[model samples]
Target: MTLSNLNGVPGREDAVREYVQQQLGGLVDDLRVDALGNLIAFRAGRDAPNGKVKERVMLSAHMDEIGFLVRYIDERGFLRLQPLGGFDPRNLFARNVTVQTRGGTLPGVLTPGGRPIHISNPEDRSKVPELRAFFVDLGLDAAAVRQQVRVGDMVTLDQQARRMGDLVVGKALDDRASVFMQLEVLRQLTGPPRHDLYAVFSTQEEVGLRGAVTAAYSVQPTIGIGLDVTLAVDTPGVEADEAVTRMGEGIGIKVYDSSMISTRWLVDEFVDLAEQAGVAYQLEVLSQGGTDGAAIQGSRSGVPTLTLSLPTRYIHSVTEAVHVSDLEAGVALLLAYLK
Candidate 1:
């Protein structure tokens, strides 16, 4: 839920990983990271029946989101940035942002690189700002700004989390919500899964699904489930057909996405379980965006894979919204799947 807090916190993924580790420390059998920097945690399965090598279950939630870095410092103490992820130009005016410097955090607002409004023309106003046209003002001189912020300083939006009834509204929830869900499942597991369970918190999903490629190769799970958030376009502007899913609905069973096509048999089994358990659920066919399952499914010999997603709204924005009830359903469905 610390989307704003995590923005611009690129490569500082270890900090988030450490936070998760501390949160689940005593409960997990082991907690560590793969060479590619994914947060890997192990919760041994209930004393493997007959002492067999337990089957593995890989769970992943991306810890990264779009953000920016300090690209240039201007004479007037303004800061230029290089975007780390896709950013919409329409939403880049006078918005508060965080300049995460090496020394300390400095708060600032983003505005286009331009002259005073007194001399600006109507056409200039019509021209929506470009990502390159924006600059962050940290309220400091050029030398002081340079001293505090480095070339690659992380910068995230300042829209802190807000409560929307039982739902949570914040940035980076695109997948952290799933990260929380995974831990909650482990908390409820009480024992190991039917097979070996490997909870893998992946990295660089927004960029290229990099962490999972290495992780899938290493873990080799027979079945992989990418736990993440999916678009729930229940709001205005989007037509019913254009919307991928809806709010307050159950977990999304990914049939296919740009990255991979989940096995037909596995998808059917998930639906069956959801129905039998009376858990609210729905089918999904994402137009784009992929999860860790894709990477794992193709790794090595090939493994059956699927995505278990929490229905989220305003994805990739400073405020990703998800109903609390839906999040709970996602956890329950995963538990049912594991059993």
Candidate 2:
């Protein structure tokens, strides 16, 4: 199986799911994709060296990324889009994008319709570009475009994963980076698990924790750990207090998000394990956005839920950045917890 790049870059989940299944092989005792298309991977405690029986543990990372969906094609052959996830209009203008159409993937650039900067006055510059004002140009005529693309086709920003100094940058790193960590944890995990383990790769996380809600109810694990990306506004931010985390620090032990408040014991356990394992970490309390942990926490009878996050910069944009050290820290903590 090849690598799956399901970072909402269009048609990524199928590849990711296939790669995971192949990697698990005989190790995965059970695997199933739900109606919502969440890939559930199961491995047992008995498979470990100690073979001690333990309750189920759920680990999840969202597979969805914020992107555009083709909604309308005007007579001029420009395609209008509807956002599949939250996006800042400021980031949309003059950005390159890839459109997945009926014919194939078409490369294009998204630009807002307005006067060029050279001709525009300062007042025009001050005007914020509404999302609806943007359109993608594929350099094709109307007939050609209509034949190649269709409404509801997927569109993703043209971004590539690359090493930027000590960090990785690309779109969808908000969760794709977390997904990579979860896979690494599964791969490098040598210790015996104490309980039935379910590693869930969920969908539609960008819009809300919708996929997680259903997946958690199905697994009903005693504990749930939502793997995600937290803030790293270490850049030239307006203020430092708002920066929830620091890049290269380590995994983030999330204290709060809009959707869920982490269980105290679970958060403490993560903290202790990180310390004992010599894993670098930071405490996070995000004032905005949430992850799958909330859905798992709201599951039947309420599961003790926590989140481990990789610190990220430029979230929901074309070039989300995450430090390698932070991802390593997440793996370290997760491995320690499994032990």
Worst 10 residues of 1 by lDDT: 2-11
- In candidate 1, list every pair of residues with a backbone clash: 8-155, 45-192, 46-192, 55-196, 56-196
Q: What lDDT score goes with residue 141 in model 1?
A: 80
RMSD of each: 2.3, 2.6
| Model 1, runs deviating above 4 Å | 2-8, 47-54, 115-119
lDDT tens digits, residue span 1-339, model 1: 653245524465665676677778776788878887888887766656675756688888877777788898877778899887667877667889888777878989888877657999998877887899899988788888877888878787778888888789987787778888988888888766776688987777776788888888887788888988888898898899877888888888888788889889989999999999988987888898878788888889899888887888888787788888888889999898776
TM-score of 1: 0.93
lDDT of 2 by residue, 191-259 (tens): 456567899988788777888888998998988999988878988834889888999888899999998
The parts of candidate 2 lying over 4 Å away from their true place are 1-12, 47-53
